[model samples]
Target: MQLLLAHVTGIQLSVRGVWELLRTHGWSCRQPARRAIERSEAAVAGWIKETWPSAKPLPRRSGPGSSSRTRPLSR
Candidate 1:
């Protein structure tokens, strides 16, 4: 992507060259979410529900105020 743009614009850069540039500039690729080894799925869900707008994001015009979204529990 960026390498393509650079090459077309006469910058002359390869994928490896871009990688080297990033490394030299002390930049790193994005990383995944870091979770504890002893993560509790139920606890995480509970936390999300309790802390997320208090719940999930409800669709628009679902009958409610804008304070937060009330998510219906799925069976």
Candidate 2:
């Protein structure tokens, strides 16, 4: 509202009013993701078991110290 107030000369709009207008226009409120509705549980489970492991694979520790850049550069 602070940013919007600057653009208008005298119009007053509250956060509640803005949300009401968005709702009236068939807009969803606070939907972070829609996958829970469209995606199936079995498919998600399968991906987690198969594709997810490869997609976000655990770090290949080149024997522990090799992966740690925070250690002394010479060490």
Evaluated with TM-score, which candidate comes out highest? 2
Tens-digit lDDT track for model 1 on 1-75? 566768677786778887887789888897857978999999988887788874666877655445445865444
Predicted candidate 2 versus true structure: per-residue lDDT over 1-75, tens digit per residue:
534753774656677776776689988657666555676899889999989878896888564354577775454
As for candidate 2, its clashing pairs are none
What C-alpha lDDT, on a 0 to 100 scale, does residue 70 get in candidate 1? 81
TM-score of 1: 0.32
Instruction: Provide the TM-score for each candidate, comma-separated.
Output: 0.32, 0.34
Candidate 1 contains a number of clashing pairs equal to 0
